[model samples]
Target chain A: MIRTLAGLVIVLILGAVAAAVIPEMQMREELQGVGYSYASRGMDETGSSNLVTAVIVAYRGLDTLGEVVVLFCASTAVVLMLTLYPIGVKASEPSRIVAFTAKVLPAPIMLFGVYFIAHSHLSPGGGFPGGTVIASTFLLVMLGSSSVPDRNGRLPAIESLAGLSFGLLGFWGIMTAGQFLNNAFLGTGTPGSIISGGLIPLISIAIGAKVASEFSGVFKAFRNSGGEA
Target chain B: MTETLMTAIVLTLGGMMVAAGIAVLFVRDLLSAIIITGFVSLSASVMFLLMDAPDVAITEASIGAVLATMIFLWGRGKIGDDG
Candidate 1:
């Protein structure tokens, strides 16, 4: 078939292109620009074992704030759009297995999300993922059951509070340490302990709360109208 | 020995991901395409893990593979059979 041949040819070309370009995605031993500084001094500067956390949450914290704001804007836009032009199609009820799984899974999933947010500086995850994982729990419940979630409710307040917390934490850093999102003001603690990462975990928790609430709000908007948002 | 093994694994995963990506394009069923795209993302996550970036790997697996797939499937379901 033409589709098969076309796919093969496309794959061959893309594979070649990938072979050349994909190496860039790999971690280079000699990092460039501020990346080099982050790589060398991140742990020392922030006392965070995970250098990625140090860079994103400590050094380039302002950029991360911007990223969170971007997500906020997107969530806001999605909620507003769906609120105005709601989907008309009704969701098909999930299977019995899905409903049961939904009921049993949210608790453990929530715990896992919390662990990710809390241990992010010591481990591989951080706020964005931890929060999204929490949001998925709400999404699962919506998918499994016929219950209408509270769309216009207390979650927006939580979202607002979380967003404010991020800025407030930044201001606290500025007041105490003369830098935005400065981790050293609170003392970075130890390298690998749960409390070691200082402002990283706190900021991650704030981000997680904001993301979870926003996404849950979006999910609720979709569910409330009896359709996808 | 480990270097060789890692290289082989990377190539295999890369190939699998490309194949999945192509297959998604040609797949007739929307559900199958969505699942194939998730397969692509999962493979990329595994590749990320091999590349010594557990943070990227976790994000790719959780967001790119799981949540994106779920949202796509939900939207597709709502779009109905006519779509």
Candidate 2:
């Protein structure tokens, strides 16, 4: 009886929300139509054909930096948590198929990740997706290998350096263009070209490296915590 | 006709997402639940693509479907099978 009552209440609430929201949904859709103007203008401003990349890497760059920092913190927390309970036993070797797949797949995956990051201004992909793809290659390695050595300090170092470089780039922009992340500090090459988005491609590279290292470090911490046990 | 077909596809994918969500809730095994959640993410990515948000679709497909599932499975292994 209580379950039925809860279901009925949920349905009623959903219906109410739908009734209240459906009309506004059309209005919201129309509002998004106005976003096309922003897209066109943003392309002109950033000299990137991909409006989303321009918005992310040029217009709202600080937000992206904060997101990467959040990722770094989360990875750091995972590392601290895993270190609290260290497991001495090593991981077991993967099966033949898994091992072979891991060996053959990482190269292509890395190449694709680089391509995705590099072509963010022209494609649907960017640093976040590309970084995740690259990190997955590391995950594949962790799964396939038994005695994966814990690189005591290297991953964190790379993550820190990437983050620092990203910040320094922002400072450089500030000094050069009087704004925190000004894209105009660098040349905004010809539109639809690989190096067109000025600081965007460089920022994407920094974000990709930071995110990739952070995630791989998280995976390493988890693996060392006797995840295979 | 295309609109009707598109609506049908959307409904089908939405149904699959709902089914996967319910399956995740009801599944007794942790690993199976994690895998079902991955399916939910995968369906959501398809929905994002259909909505003309390919960037979001890629992020969802890569991070949500693949990475989250792998991480969950790894965490599950650490927790052991008794749970």
Candidate 3:
């Protein structure tokens, strides 16, 4: 009772504070500094209609690569720990409804996921969200089946190759443009088209592959934990 | 009129998110808490859409509400679903 009351009091106080301060907060008038440049030149220079993708894959490519590395490390750690200490997972056959839905849904789900990754430069979704959708498809498959499907290390291989592709593309940029992950080396094609963003689309594909593989590996590890798959 | 409707919707979502966030802390069962947490994320996704960030909204809805909830439920199952 006392904890609830205390929480309520704290929330009320915070709400009051926010109400007092929010109206005074200034809204940004326009894109400025790096943001302005990215907004104006991002589409033309990178040839990606999606400004966000251009910035992520071209302007700050190294940082994005670092982020991918971070994801790799985290996924690696989870897989390693789970392998070391396997949980006893009993994979029971799901209900008829769930099994039927899972079987029917994965095809369309996979299609949407690929579309998301492929059209990321022209749309809102990029590698991360698209890759996650793909991983979720695998999750659905795992849930519907009676047993965990063994990939026999295919996921890790895909992950490594995808990660390698990202680095190789950067090195390719260095050879041509004297900069890592330069998207302009191939000549900026017409924006709003699929083949417009030079290295952006390629990098998105690599990132998408890496993310999907890593997440699938983690999910498979969880599903196959102590059970011999 | 449209602007006012959006503002009202945003305010409603924000209030529900706050309520859910608080309710999660008080909930005894772990499953209920996890579902409520997903609810909070779902509300936040709506708020992001209202703020003209469809990308953020999609990511949040998928990763936060869907993926995270599934992962949590899986973990809870592993640990024995008394939670």
Candidate 4:
């Protein structure tokens, strides 16, 4: 009874606080102008048509690096979870319907994923979305076949290479522009085109590889756990 | 013009999110509950985009759509049918 009362009191307090705070949290309408200005300047300076990509890769590259690290850490955690306990059972092959869909899905999805990442600097989608799609394609393959190739080793390899490349690129930026992760290596070109942004596309590719590997690792880990248990 | 339309869409998405949350609460099956939770994340991402937080929206959508969904699936298998 005491515990229940305590929980109720806590809930009441939380409710009161939320009621007070939520009014102030109304969506700030001023951001559209600010975001537009930042985007415009970014485009003029970086020669990238995609405002969001420029912000992500050039102005906030460090944050993007941190995001990648977070993904890598998540991948490690999932892999650990899978490896710590042995699940020796193998899953059966998918049904005919699942198999046919899985086989058909990968080609188009992978192609689209690649295109999105490559053109991230010039369009709406970016590395994370593209990478998730790529991972989903791999997941489909796993769903379709019991003999799906385990990609654990390859994942780590790609992750490490991407990490290394990102670091080297950032270092190059610091040397040239006195700012880390600057798109210094990417020469000036017209905006609103795929080839315009220098480091944006490169960064997008790196992020894509990292996200894909990390997500695939998670799916595999979960599958392994289910089979083992 | 597009902005106003976007705001209306965001409001609609927000309503759907509340409904999805309610649905998640009422759903008996754990897997279906998890799937509904994905829709909630998706709805939140749409709202974020409307608010001009595209970067945050992308992150939320990706993590919400991919990582959270996978985690929920694993949790379902572990928890079995228990409430």
Candidate number with greatest TM-score: 3
Model 2 residue A229 CA deviation (Å) reads 12
* DockQ top scorer: 2
- List clashing residue pairs in candidate 4: A87-A228
Give the alpha carbon lDDT tens digit for every residue of A1-229 in model 3: 9998999899899999999999988898998899999998888899898887888889999999999999999999989999899888776768999989989999999899888889988999888888888888888888887766555768888999999999999999999999888889998799888888888888988999999889888889888778576
- Rank all candidate structures by their DockQ, best first, as comma-separated numbers: 2, 3, 1, 4
TM-score of 3: 0.91
Task: Write down the worst ten-residue block by lDDT for model 2 chain A.
Answer: A25-34
In model 3, state the lDDT of residue A225. Answer: 78
Query: Which residues of candidate 2, in runs, are more than 4 Å off?
Result: A1-15, A27-37, A87-90, A149-152, A227-229, B81-83
- Identify the CAPRI category of the predicted complex in candidate 1: medium
Writing each residue's lDDT as its tens digit, candidate 4 over B1-83 gives 99798778877887889899989978998888899999999888878887776766876887797668877876666657785
- Chain B TM-score against the true chain B, each candidate: 0.90, 0.92, 0.88, 0.88
Error of 3 at A14 (Å): 8.5
Write down the TM-score of every candidate.
Answer: 0.87, 0.90, 0.91, 0.84
Candidate 1, residues B1-83, lDDT tens digits: the string is 99999999988888888888879877889889999999998888898888799988888888887778876876887785454
lDDT of 3 at A103: 91
Q: A87 in model 3: Cα distance from truth in Å?
A: 1.6
Go through the candidates in order and give each one's DockQ. 0.70, 0.77, 0.71, 0.42
For model 4, state the Cα shift of residue A94 in Å. 1.2
Off by over 4 Å in 4: A1-8, A25-37, A87-90, A226-229, B1-13, B49-63
Cα lDDT tens digits for candidate 2, A1-229:
9998999899899999999988775534443554776675888788888888888898889998898888888888988988887755457768899888888999999999999899999989999899999998888887877755445658888888999999999999989998898997688888888868899998989998998898898888877776554
For candidate 1, give the lDDT of residue A147.
76
